[model samples]
Target chain A: MLSFYICLRKIPPMTEPRINPNVSVDCVIFSFEDDGLEVLLIERNAGQNRIEDDLLALPGNLIYEDETLDAAANRVLRELTGLKNIYLEQVYTFGDPARINKQKDQDWLHSIRAHPEARVITVAYTSLVKKSNFKISPSSFARQAMWVKVKEVPQLAFDHNALLEKALEYLKHKIYIEPLGYELLPERFTLAQLQKLYEAILDDHFDKRNFRRKVLRTSFIIPLNEKQKGVAHKPAGLYRFDKSKFHKI
Target chain B: MLSFYICLRKIPPMTEPRINPNVSVDCVIFSFEDDGLEVLLIERNAGQNRIEDDLLALPGNLIYEDETLDAAANRVLRELTGLKNIYLEQVYTFGDPARINKQKDQDWLHSIRAHPEARVITVAYTSLVKKSNFKISPSSFARQAMWVKVKEVPQLAFDHNALLEKALEYLKHKIYIEPLGYELLPERFTLAQLQKLYEAILDDHFDKRNFRRKVLRTSFIIPLNEKQKGVAHKPAGLYRFDKSKFHKI
Candidate 1:
């Protein structure tokens, strides 16, 4: 039986067809902060029956028919989290007819979707944002939007857990090639902080001395004249990324 | 407005729903040979009207609802080309609503698909195949399956040209990171052949002496005892990739 009556945001007038029931978009939004690597999740609210109510899922919804995939991703993120202009990269598409065959999933979809039995193909995306950049407040059908550490995330709704795993794998591989870790940090940060970010994502420890030596050699990681303040121990020098230098290299 | 009625292969009986109209899979199969890097394309056959019927496209079709995205990609490749076990990598998913909104495209879809107006989201894959490994025979709706040099390809159907561009960019970036170019070569190849493969993919020339010197320094490329057979010029030494050595590094 359906446990919740999830109401999606009403669509505005569009020149093209209203919405494509067969296609949806999901996002694995990641942020780095005091809790290490964290991912944004939405807790689906309960209804009168209140059965199996604590379902957590990535912020996602069916895409509007007129919008492109990227636009759909952005709109979904904004509607669920009250955040916009996020840097989202398309990771993979998940399309198995049995994806929603589980009774609980079917029941949940029955409550929300017009066509509950439609085989939805979701285009998944990976997004990175600074922890302090935006405030999150759940909207539409979501009860609450919150950040959970990647390691501590419970079994998510739909195939979201698999999506999260793929996103992490993408991040792991991408970090080695690109300086994407900086997206999670502040404008100015220390080498230790940067190393910690890498360690959290890679789930491994690095020799402090060697890590610093290697990072300093890169033209992008420029050491600023500033230093850390309000620390009980010795202050660490601050650094910033040089985008022009990175592009040149 | 209909031109040619494209007849798809009959589907096997399944417990789940049949083909998902909203989801399709397209392949950008690439092979490196005498004419340089070539991509496999399908030429749609002409009908009685034959109006705008010179359509060329990536070998693709709507995916069965029961199969996963990867399985669908493999199956689509086999159905259209009569080739199996080809290594495929998912490059991207294109879901622009206007993608098939063009008049000719709409006419093409109307002639073939049951729900001609349905928005289709295609998950595109990039495949690498050796030229001499297998033969290609067009099946299903494809009038002809043929390899066209990447440079000589004309405007393709739907958003396939954009998909091909993305695949080419992926190949260019991936060649520098991984030794994927070997998938297009035989067990034994000469240094000159290797250099030519790189040149064709990168669209840039390399100093032969310097390129050979750098290649020789790599642990993975091992020089074989045999040399090229029956060449007008002096026979060159052959080399093979050492997978174990690559993994070790």
Candidate 2:
């Protein structure tokens, strides 16, 4: 049997000193809030390995040599956002050659050169987490990390805007087939919050009566004996996703 | 905006050689016959560039440069099978790294070195085509190309046997959501042939009455005014896939 290191070394060298960029994982963490669906964004450091010093982008990192892609994604979430045990799925591998070029800055090139150890080809992933669980770190490279409404996400660095859009599309497609909505909201959430999350990602208003009926028909949501508090109107009964009944389509 | 070629050149070299020796696409091009489901298989030649000598394998090729994964797949199907415009989809990307190492000959490495022009990262894609349509070319390296029963697929070279298993799994999954079975048979076919095709892939005995009921429920089957001519049993009604409705799902 070929040893692992020999197997790794056996890969043919490129025709030239070509950079076969290493694979990394980027997480688009989404959460449901009172306003609408929100995504976590981090303010990048202004210099030294920071491409867009002031720009916002998804939390991401290079995969370790020994880790699986999913494991790398979990590590990123834990390290960056101080949250764990969230629902994460591989969305797509963004290999369009133009992705890095879209970031028109000398700083980007310098940053890449500065970190010769990091050859990153990011595999974008999406995670749905409860908004309350995060304790965003004020890391040296990031000034702040906060959740912003999906609609208000501005000019993000790299191909992040595109990645976010793809993630949202995936979210909409998955919501119909899988019980993914539970990941975005609190453990016990009002039906209205759930509906708003759907509407935000779907970008259309659903008839409240029809929406409730369709969700209830899935048989994965269980109405709890709990109710929301501090609302101006009648408090809606809280519901939770029944994990036992949830199956991927 | 970066010029396309410039954009391409600026991208990092594929970290490893673009081709992985293990992964590959083995097409199971099915054609309708009087008896049942038939798939195309080729007898490989042992020329300098010909990798699989004196063995049978589904028509396949390695993934290529700057190509969309799907495009590379279509290219392989067209080149090896001489069939185009057939239904093609990425069934899966297999990366059991140890699979290549398990082969005793390590002929895959010699094959890679033999063809300096070719970079072989085998990404296997499965395509379903009406068996009647393909015009097999008599290439010097290939001894012969012929239709074979899915039940008796020859011992394939490399990890092709595993790839075929994955393809069959994908076909079963796709059959439920899409009208892909029609691609395997002729434009017009008896219900028995359709049932047999399903049985071949699913590898289970399905009740004819129940299978027929489910097939008809799909509403994408258009019953023709014709019937089977020389069947030993009752003449079955012929049907074609309703193209307009087939793709809607």
Which is the leading candidate under TM-score?
1
Q: How much of the real interface does each model capture, measured as fnat?
A: 0.86, 0.00
lDDT of 1 at B239: 96
DockQ of candidates 1 onward, in order?
0.66, 0.09
By TM-score, how accurate is candidate 1?
A: 0.88
lDDT of 1 by residue, B139-245 (tens): 87677899999999999889889999999988986787777657988989988888999998888999999999999898899999999889999999999988777
Q: Candidate 1 on A1-249: residue-level lDDT in tens?
A: 133323223445445558788899999999998658999999775444444655689999899878999999999999888988898999988877677777777777877778988878898999789979999977877778999999899988888999999999889877877888568989999999999999988889999999999999999999999999999999999999987778622
iRMS (Å) per candidate: 1.2, 5.1
Q: List the residue pairs that clash in candidate 2.
A: A19-B13, A20-B14, A20-B15, B19-B121, B20-B121, B23-B122, B24-B122, B24-B124, B25-B124, B31-B131
Which tens-of-lDDT digit does each residue in A74-165 have in candidate 2?
A: 87777776767776787765544345554442354456444533323466789777777766764635556888988899988777898899
Using Cα atoms with residue i matched to residue i, what is each candidate's TM-score against the true structure? 0.88, 0.69
- Computed on C-alpha atoms, the DockQ of candidate 2 is 0.09
